[model samples]
Target: MKVNRFGRQAIVAGAAVATASMLLAGCTGTSSSPTASADPNATLVFGITADPTQTIPWTTTSEQSVQVLSQIYSPLLTTNKDDQPVANLADLPKVSSDGLTYTFTLKDGLKFSNGSALDSADVKYTYEKIMDPASKASSRSYLASVASIDTPSPTTVVVHLSKPDASFPSGLTAVNTGIVPSDVSVDSLQTTPVGSGPYKWAGRVANESISLERNPDFFGGKPGAAKVEFRIIPDDQSMVSALKTGSVDVAIFDNPVTAKTAVSNKTKSMEAASLQYHVLQLRAASPVLSNVNSRLAIQCAISRQDVIDTAALGSGTVTGPITSPEYRSDPKAQPCAKQDLKKAKEYMQKAGTPDGFTLNVMTSQGLYSTAVDEAQNVQAQLGKVGIKVNVQALDSNAYVQKWLAGDFDAAIAQNAGSADPNTMYARYFTSGGTYNKVAGYSSPELDKLFADGIATTDTAKRKTVYTQLSKELVDNAAWVWLFTPKEYIVLNSSVTGFEARYDADVSTLWKASLS
Candidate 1:
């Protein structure tokens, strides 16, 4: 849920890319409007996936599924194209010397699309509403900070953390943490939400589509895309076909390394890695995977290189669920060590299975395919190591629900990229949490490590703590990490000044330019 840190954007749609003449270059193409160099008055039609869980910014963490998600909401802060933490609504993020408190200065003259001035009160209201149990907002974990919010005036607010949380600002920039007007009602907020973003919720066509018009009052300046249209498609292939038929201008696909080259070269559209990265989620609570040995077997048997080569389409590399090797605290840990045939085979036998155990692999049908393909490849590779696997492909929605409910032995999912490694590694490792939790993993040592890391703002100490935490997580084998994907994107040559970030959410709608 945390974004705007390091300018990482979440890719709401699962598989993101493409190019064909009929599919791309049309009078009504995605970039059909006049160029920024010419008229600069053309409408841009950007495509995204289905309905969001909720439009309530405070509650819409993974709302990238809905094209209208972040467009209708604005966070207190946002990461620029460079991925540095910068002021979106509030001024620069400030931390306490002890790292327990945070102070934010609001940007001047920022107004919601509905004309309500965005102020500290709005920030306070939105946070309290999300944190409030009665609100039942699904993504409350995003605001772990803030014992209280003191709004000294309309423009100034101070957030007091229960403990030191140096990474709190990352939460502030998260789409789910977007601030709302203090006066907006739950009913009103749900129906016709407003924000200080690039676009305003013009109207909705119910479950089918969301229509938004650019907000002229945006503090960042008017968006180049005059009018934005987002249509939800439940099927991945259909979404691709829509792009082919020109019904959709952009198709956000999760390409395997092999497919990326084709998708990138094939489509006029480009693929960019949103914050979320691909993964193989092994449920830690399951007796099968709970044993560190079983996890290690799967880690060894399944060719991480094959996954990296075939499924990731060269866009990914081997990594863990919480921490990838690239983002590892200790280079020595080297997440997901090479396949130790003898060790893996020996471990499987010690675990009471001379042959590998069979388990259902739940993956999203409409989302990414790397997990499913990885599962099959893992099945074969594990067979070599004497492990049998049964892959189960489910609807993206069903996969999400059942996997989170601990209904599967193992599942395929993604990290969706994190603004910082804290959100990437530490957040999910917490107990009784599920925003990005994989494998129902929990530990006292992990809790302490995470707590220590979050409480201390010191980079060196935090790194040491995170390094320890990463080792502990790997030892536990909570989730079988697949790889950290290098996202690919193909954009029309005309779309210039576009921002590339790590969060999966759409920041380009506002921050992106035509020229």
Candidate 2:
């Protein structure tokens, strides 16, 4: 799933004063604790760049929403500090020898925030809802192989898969797969969610803040913080100011400049190497982009390093499709790692557009801090090879709707990577994938490689299969793969126990407290 980019500085610059006013208004009762001793009852104000569009766990692909939802909803499984799948709502599943069946037992005395008993029925219902086309879940593809689910008893859940999938267990650990009560209305869950997680949804002031209180019925005992408030601070500079003034105890910043500003203000910060990357997506179905040479030309013409340096202030590493260490493609192996205007021109000539061609690139203003900058940089770079790139900047909502509908010539996008290559790229590369249209291209060979990768449980064999798939994607110029930026979590000096995850998970806040 692609995580929406953060750091919308331009769009919210004028609203900074109004935003700060709202923050101050909301923080009247919740005081900061910069000099106080460790207090578990303190309200931990978390600053986020954007308001969550989707609060229903399975329906959203946004990282901002996932961060909040992860606290309100607990999945059957979750990842440990090492990124390995671990039990959450249920004990570790017992897999059959064939790897086609998994049996899970619900944790003893599990109960939702509403005081309703949670059992295997909720788990079964959650997975079924995700697989239902009506749900339009972003994670529907994750449970593609689930043939049927059987709840033999109140605590026992047996999942039967059509075929063997080595990554199946890990897929269940995604935040989107969080369990919801079997009887809960899907529509109501968006505003009023009920789960067995550490926190319960208290209230939300649209576009201003979201509040959560500790769940008394949580199976995981008591959460560290009594209350958690997620304040929507659209402007990065404003977030830095909030950190400096002790208005916000913790905030996540994707913009290196903003992060540096926060740190200079005496805030404690840690940088986590995230599995998130930015990409220039060429719609292969578009008239000009349909030609492989044209896509290849665009890929060869742009310098990823230049984009990183200018847009991200050199705070990222050039990356390929896969970000996981074991199966990642070597960036150096990419054809145009170093700009090749000569080769670019040759491809353009082969594309039957030797003189010049106009390319319309759509980007979101105030979505990602560097979105417009990156697009403009590509526009300038592509100009050297006869491509006239027109950069179109739109609001985040418009951009997301258009992008998801595959209504674009090209787009500048930020996407989330996964520990398993199959879990990351399968939905984009498979013929029947939910995002196949958005991806704009797929072939039998690519689909076969994806199938082969997940069919085996052997790590070495899976790595070899993914290596081939990665090459195929780059060789065909699936998307202009850019760099993965480091995500910074800035905290007040008094905040303790918060640890950053490689995936930029904020659920660790359940253990965080004010010192």
Candidate 3:
């Protein structure tokens, strides 16, 4: 699955923060010790930009954490590069004609690395854990439609949803709910994930590295490498140095500036459309942003092209209402209006732009590679329209906290992409929706469209409803849809079979060979 996108990370981060304290004891070092030097020919050392906040399934919102756990666990379903559902541990699920029931056939002879048989019981256990409110699994919302699960046999599992959910199958691809042995305690399961995936947990060195050894008995087939090492080197410069010295075979650079530098000898740079976008989120309650004209002025001031050129090195796609380009349809939503200082000033005057009214634009200092740069660009552009802007860089966690709490006037933040329009649109448009916390904006018409869109499985009908919602969102100037960065996956010349994914999930390591 495309696992590395910021949208999913932001959604998961909300739940992760709520349950972080509960995981401290379970995620401490395991009983196992690190093994001696891994044979280079038999191992693939991959460099990740940041350490995972937690290793436990369903408790972490960090994509880096998902990248690590994906190597050690297997989901019932996985996604292709197009974000379409694909069978992984289970065969293609058979959906009922009404679309309310889904039946999955488990692959034969699946077993956890510990040698425990993986069966329908494990699938049941996984969902039950997520459904249990006490477990506080971040995946709980994804399965909220599931009314009940029936395990008819060791190999057959059935799910009955309360209503038709065309997107239900995609939820099965979530790495947070990867199947685990039914007998293990939730506490131990969080720390020592045991699954039937291609790799087994070897050991971890906090803030430094994590190791996974190939599972010889893996159901998918043994991995190409004997072991895999994820070296967590946070700084782009440090990672570039590591790549040059052969300390790591592959490096995932969050900053395009660093990625561009990796296009040289002994390493090749690969790029993919990140299922992530940066946006200027405005709060509806803030006096400066409350008026539609004021919002429109702010939106008209930003030249997305310039922001992309400055922050992404001219390598990202400019965005509009339909942030996911792959999902855009006929009568495409109009892109942001061209920068017009005169028009923006006129709108500001109409909205009674207060004298000395300065908007605080919050952004992440280091976590988001381009947030501060983007904010500065926005500040410069908005200044041309006679609007004073102040950029404040905050810690990533604190930024999300303020965003969720609706405490900031405006901020630049990364958001996730979705295969289904309902998943992304509803959260930002519907009343009390997850992402809708920003702006405290609510639209009855848009909410109705979301309800109708997700309820009908007919593709043509769904498209009409979504297209309408997209138009409504943009007309309101709900946000300034910025740009989607072109992310690069850099690897050593000796590595093979590695491919970059839009979602950025580290699970791609499954097919990779080191030598």
Q: Name the candidate that leads on lDDT.
A: 2
lDDT of 2 by residue, 262-298 (tens): 7644467776667778999987888979999999999
User: By TM-score, who's the top model here?
Assistant: 2
Please list the residue runs of candidate 1 whose C-alpha ends up more than 4 Å from where it truly belongs after superposition. 1-41, 49-53, 61-63, 133-139, 204-208, 233-247, 256-275, 321-336, 432-438, 503-505, 511-515
How much is 296 displaced in model 1, in angstroms?
Answer: 2.7
What does candidate 1's lDDT look like per residue over 1-515, in tens digits?
11011111212212332222223213221332254472256555554444454677655433354346677777888776545568778788576777766788888898988898888888888899888866755446667666998988888888888887766776666677777888878788787888888888877665466777889898878686677677666555555555555565444555522223323332444334444555667777777777777877776666677665545444554554434223453323643477668878877877777766777777655444455555566666778887777888675566666754568777767655555566665546678343435446778887787778777667778777777777886666666666765443334444544554453346656644444
- Clash tally for model 1: 49
In order, the Cα lDDT scores of the candidates are 0.62, 0.81, 0.71
Clashing pairs in 3: 2-503, 3-505, 4-503, 4-504, 4-505, 7-415, 7-416
- TM-scores of all models? 0.83, 0.91, 0.83
Cand. 2 TM to true fold: 0.91
Pairwise TM-score winner, candidates 2 and 3: 2
Worst 10 residues of 3 by lDDT: 24-33
Question: Comparing 2 and 3 by lDDT, which wins?
Answer: 2
